[model samples]
Target: MQKLHKLLRMGDLAAFVGIVDDGGFAEAARRRGMSASTLSRSVTRLEEQLKVTLLRRTTRSIEITSEGAAVLAEAREILNRSETLKEIATSGQAPAGPLRVNAPVPFVLHVLAPRLAEFHANYPAIQLSIDMTDTLVDLIGSHADVAIRLGRLQDSEMLHRPIGRTAWKLVAAPDYLDRKGWPEALADLARLEQVRFAAPDHINTLRFIGMADPLEIPASVTANNGEAVRQLVLRGLGVARFSDFMIADDIRAGRLVELFSGQLDAEPLEISALYLTRVSGLRRLGVFLDWLDAIQVG
Candidate 1:
């Protein structure tokens, strides 16, 4: 029988796989928050122990040998099984270890960030790594433990739980509307200056509940981020659509005014937490999801 314990180190296998997945030792080290030399040493040790030339390295790049490709496949399986074992071990234990979370910028700033301090206080052992961006991310490829998504979710094998919803409103600053005059009909929207959310697939139209055709509007200004669009509208630039969570206080304080409330019937954006089923039994994820459920989000 093979001496499994003495055959090779699990950490060395992981490092080799990381080096290949990240495309190089330096990048793997950077993403893993370790030094490049350490990863290089791990791969070197792995190669020596296996008696196989895993990678052919040049000054500029690396080429993986056939042996390396075979080893990589096995290493991925072993590492994944190791993670599943960890999940099983911690299923009933106190919530601990690292949790990677992904969310959009607006939700991160307006909803999640405010509650982070209290969450840390409650579960001091749980480490958090949060990545904030508006663009969608591949959860498994990005190694995210959970992703908080807005709007409709695409069809996927990942499991999701609804967190809450936020109403969308057509809004503008008081001074801007006062200067341009209030819109009397849906047709008036096309004539008004508008601040638009900048995206490649962004539509320059609004779809109402009972409308047959979407109403097209002109974009006076464009911003890639929701917060930037909010700022533009606040500065009396033009009328823009905003989620209630971003401007509820401003609406109540009269800094911004909601327009065509009776006419606009845009559906509320649904908030949800997405994760892989493999991690569904983890206590730390469970604790975090429970906290998300308890918190009130606009």
Candidate 2:
């Protein structure tokens, strides 16, 4: 037991996890505000203690071996267990730690930004690192404790909790509609230029409630970010289909006009909070999820 204690250190395991999570010693050190050499030494010591070559380091990159992957999985479990132990020790105190979250830009701006103050007030000790990107990010690789995803989730090993749903709204700025005549019939969309979402799931065709055939629309501009597309539409550039949570304020304020409001037959996008199954019991995560559940963005 004494030999094992001498060989293994929790700090070393944490450094190893941090190195892999950030993809490089320099990056992990920079993110943690530590020296890269210190992180490199910790990884070396961990490798020596474990008696396996966990990582193959190159000048520009570090590649994880199969053994490294296995170790990383165990390391994450151990770290999460340690965090749980801490929470257990201080049952009455507020949970605290860094909580990294990955989410889309529009959701971050429209939905989360407003409620953040309240969340911070509730858990003031919690440090939040929010990565706002329209593209899908790997939860482990990005080092995100939680990820807010939209649409039908693909097959994943991570655990997910369905938060709510949001439907797409076809909208255009009043000035744009005035300049380009309002689309009366579905066929009129052919003449209109649209600001489209540049995602794999985004389709060029539209399906209406009563229509037998799907209508294909012309895409004049395509952006990966939802906010960018909304901005383009607001500037009288073209028509756009945005999620209801995003356009609710704009529609109410008459900044944008909703076209075919209740006539479209489309599946509502599923909003889910995804996380590693190991960290599901963590108090900090639970608090955030509870807050999310209360908001119910749909």
Model 2 Cα lDDT, one tens digit per residue, 1-298:
2243345788988999898888889899999899999998998898887888999999999999998888887777777777878878877888788899999988999999989999999999889999998888888877888999988899566688889999888888998888778889888877878887777535435778989987677777887778888999999888877789999999999999998889777888899999884444577888898899999887
Q: Could you tell me which 10 consecutive residues in candidate 2 have the lowest summed lDDT?
A: 1-10
Candidate 2 regions with alpha-carbon error over 4 angstroms = 1-6, 201-203, 277-280
Model 1 C-alpha RMSD vs. true structure (Å) is 3.3
**What does candidate 1 score on TM?**
0.83
For model 1, the superposed segments whose C-alpha errors exceed 4 Å read: 1-6, 48-77, 84-93, 200-204, 296-298
Considering only N, C-alpha and C atoms within 3 Å, which residue pairs clash in candidate 1?
A: none
Residue 150 error for model 2, in Å? 0.3
Clash count, candidate 1: 0
The Cα error of candidate 2 at residue 104, in Å, is 0.9
lDDT winner: 2
